[model samples]
Target: MSSLLDLHPMTRRSLLGGLAATGALVVLHPFAARAASNQAHLRLMETTDIHVNLMPYDYYADKPNDTLGLSRTASLIDGIRAEATNSMLIDNGDLLQGSPMGDYMAYKKGMKAGDLHPVMKAMNVLGYDCGTLGNHEFNYGLDFMFNTLAAAKHPIVCANLTKGQLASDPKNDELFFKPFVIIEKKIKDGAGHESPVKVGFIGFVPPQIMVWDAKNLEGKAQTRDIVEAARAWVPVMKEQGADIVIALSHSGIDAKGPSEKMENASLYLAGVEGIDAIFTGHQHLVFPGPKTWDGMQGVDAVKGTLMGKPAVMAGFWGSHMGLIDLLLEKDGKSWKIVDFTSEARPIYHRDEAKKIIADTKDKPEVVAAVQEEHEATLAYVRTPVGKTSAPLYSYFALVADDPSVQIVSNAQLWYIKDMLKETQYKDYPVLSAAAPFKAGGRGGADYYTDVPAGDIAIKNVSDLYLYPNTVQAVLITGAQVKNWLEMSAGMFNQIKPGSKDADLLNLDFPSYNYDVIDGVTYEIDLSEPAKYDKDGKEANPQANRIKNLSFNGKPIDPQQKFVVVTNNYRAGGGGKFPEIAGDKVIFVGPDTNRDVIVRYIISQGTINPSADGNWRFAALPGTTAVFQTGPKGRPFASKVIGAKIEDAGDGTEGFAKYRLIL
Candidate 1:
């Protein structure tokens, strides 16, 4: 039902007389001059999951492009705002620490009072009204976040953050962002009088910040759950006499449990009353359109309302700006939206001559500021990181004791073994677990780091180790450790022994959480159903997807204790890996996982690494397979080099296929 309801004011009558009378004059009728005067249509704009892409601005590239900069988005914002009567721009978190700009600020550039963080600088030029906190904000700790946020002209709203034992306290909040803001504005009426509307906005972040950013916020502060916190605060928002309520969620949309499990947080939150519209991020996705997950009803394509309300999660980086237009019907003292449409505004559109021009005029000031930082960071992004003789690749991660994980584990164990020399668990066998982060998903082909044949530079290093996560080792029994792999095996759907083109895998599963234990050997039996416990417990250990679990040709003894090295998040149950939780954590290493890998590379001085028979795709004989995978993966056939891959041509950027190996 998308329609062209309104036309340019001048074009209303076709003004046939103008076309007939003024030959060249009517050719350049600006789109802005078309709308009515009482155009109080609120344009709710969003920048979701912008993981520090300041350049294009890609922190990964360390250069500037016309595509992603808030500068580019600013062009679209101007056009949309000019067409609307009123508007509000918001960022949905994960904004602070993903790119090299953030890395430069943290390690090289360093932050100080009044120092303009590039992303914040761009936001300042756009004049964003408010934003919510994404998990990445705490990566560098509270001081940097506090100082940078203080520099922004907008309000940062997050409700679940705790200050003291009570929900309200001076010490418990983010210390800068307000929990919510009630914005009031006037709209012109047909009588030439002003009418008032009150817009209530509140923000929430995923409660798991405690696990993911423990390096930043463990004993320093506490955060409550997103839903529980909203329940406690949204009522207060209503009591304040606010009209429309919106949630700026750093969390993603949710569907029913079982298949989705922890995935459907938004749907659960939507079930919460009074939440009029939800602007979601974190798991960056496009919603309410043609996209839908497997085996869900309304989700095959969500309607404008969930639990009777509008919700949207725009695509990530500066790719698109989510624009939701709601038509409100005035009812007595309150106004309820009668209908609505949500879409992302492209940064460019076809002009009269069919040339893709700026969606609107690019804002010169914002572009200049962002471009300046973009260039400075570009110079700093790709410098020499360290040398490695070993090659690190994820080709065999699912099957064997990999050298990449071995290097990381060795580094973690080496770093911690001495520090815990006096501890009782120091006598146990130590192993390290690490997952591949950048593997050609949304990052494109070059995203895969093959620092081949020579010195590894800083640019390639960023590709290999994207995040600045610290190392951590947890204590677990040999049995519990075995169960942990069973959970990871869930990443693969059950590929039948002789099935064709069935993905039997969940490629969308993030590799950061996909920990592979380099100290053990096991095989995934594509023929069997996976046994799993939803509550993070070993409720059903007999699930048979993983077979032949052993070490040195002997079954792993359940009573044997092992010191498992991993990133801090997994040691704290980030992926709900069975038997691994914060309480079982033994040693927290000083160096980050990225630092450990980098340091390991530097230590080796010339690391020769490869898949080297660590793991393999269980041999399938004479079967043709087909299943859907992602878009970026399409161009690189090595992603499915050994299989009969279909072009699919969808550019989904995920990997799932039915296969028959002769």
Candidate 2:
């Protein structure tokens, strides 16, 4: 092969100049001159499901974690901007709530009229162009949400979230935020010629927010279907001269196709005509990745396309930055996408030894913006409440009765019993239902709750109960209670007899939905199929997974009424559990579940949060099943209640594998 050095001096100079003009080498100007005059490259950057992680710190763990933080992602953003000619940064929501900092602002410091939220401050410093609302934004109620959003420098749009009743025509609905915003910007083509471009940004929140935050929403707010809203607004944006339209869908990709008010409607929303690309979140999973959404119909996992339209879902807590690079060519007077690439760029990665390695440093401006609140949050979460006789962790929550959940259940049961003392339903037997929120799943191996045995702090309590949900009690018959357990049993997959190492837990079922009801005894029969699917829809009507169900040493009576202590989310039909809805709600406490946990801990002075042998799996002789949990669980494997667990090996995504002998 002939080298450029072998060419004549004039020819070499000409070739180098041509290569520089084609952006093959570093350009001296902001926009590199291109070989073609009509071509331009526009990069759309997305940070979704940030959940107020402004710094590289974990409030619950009270330690520095390199895997998460918007400040780290901000550094990556700075580099991404330099790589593209024209770029826009946007958030796909779930930004307002997650970390202790968000709780500190909403429940402790309280957001004043003009005060900027820490998350908003960090985002503003990074110059966010636009953003959207996630379901968690409604966790603290409308007043708190609006007060926090008021301080944002950028416009926040939500097409589906309505102030009151949704109108018959989606376009006429009284939207809580503007349906969409069009940004008119000057884009420099590859030839360095500036041209006007209109990019429309529309946002959507899951309609299920009405169910999840019923106490905060209820009759006060309503929502239109995501695809329904997109169908109504995308065309209007095109007609209004939008050169490109992007959907900021705070929803996940569900291959089940579109249904009425589906929670994960991003897949269907992408099918809406006139939508050029999409930014997805709410599932806390990345798109264009090797796993997740693989082999799903109408989904191009490797290409990051849903229904043939480009899309990206950045990992939650600022783990990754979703990027979509579009190569646009002038088609008549409007720009059309001729080529594109989608990616979920991470700020950190694991090394060969499974240690988290920081890929970028924290952006100073982003960190400085939230430094005050971050310190205050650390102080607030570190306040000692009481002491625990045993450690609390959620590593094996899915496969065994866990102490992490037991503590929450104990707190809730105590709180509910006291509250019902003066109520007419005091005579009803009380049971507490709690789930493991921080189990190893989409949140990754390090997401599990691990509180050491000793003094319990507010952060430890928060880790035990991840949500800011208020305690609520639902009155239902014993039959309905059994049905609820059956619904929760959907977390497990059916295994065949004599099968070796069959998958035990259902990956599609979220750990937070695997409610473990205290004050009752039950055995899950893995030999039987799950009666209900992850969505709480009946999958096998003949299946009876809940076996040997009993209460107070006797079989539960079908006609007997009981008071089930749970969070507002569950009582309001957040998980679609059978017979557990608004009508069944008997009591709604004023304090949050975390507050109750703190109070309970204080009252105990020294508590023993041990998991009682309340629930277990029915033994299937000669059968073996396997499950994955945080690698940290290995130390406590023998302490797990129920089945005999043995170390299997290393699992995917940094999770440790355990085999269950049945």
lDDT of each prediction vs. the true structure?
Answer: 0.60, 0.83
**Cα deviation of 430, candidate 2, in Å:** 11
Candidate 1 segments exceeding 4 Å error: 1-40, 57-67, 166-176, 189-193, 257-264, 293-302, 332-334, 346-363, 387-455, 462-517, 522-549, 556-662
lDDT of 1 by residue, 130-220 (tens): 8988877887888888777878888888887664344453224453357788877565432334567778888877766665566677677
lDDT of 2: 0.83
TM-score for all predictions?
Answer: 0.62, 0.67
Residue 321 of candidate 1: its Cα lDDT?
72
Clashes, model 1 = 50
Please provide, for model 2 over 427-496, each residue's C-alpha lDDT reduced to its tens digit, 9 standing for 90 to 100: 8899999998998778898999998998878777767876656678999999999999999999989999
| Cα lDDT, model 2, residue 92 | 94
Name the lDDT value of residue 17 in candidate 2. 27
Error of 1 at 223 (Å): 1.1
Query: After superposition on all CA atoms, what RMSD does each candidate show versus the true structure?
Result: 11.9, 11.8
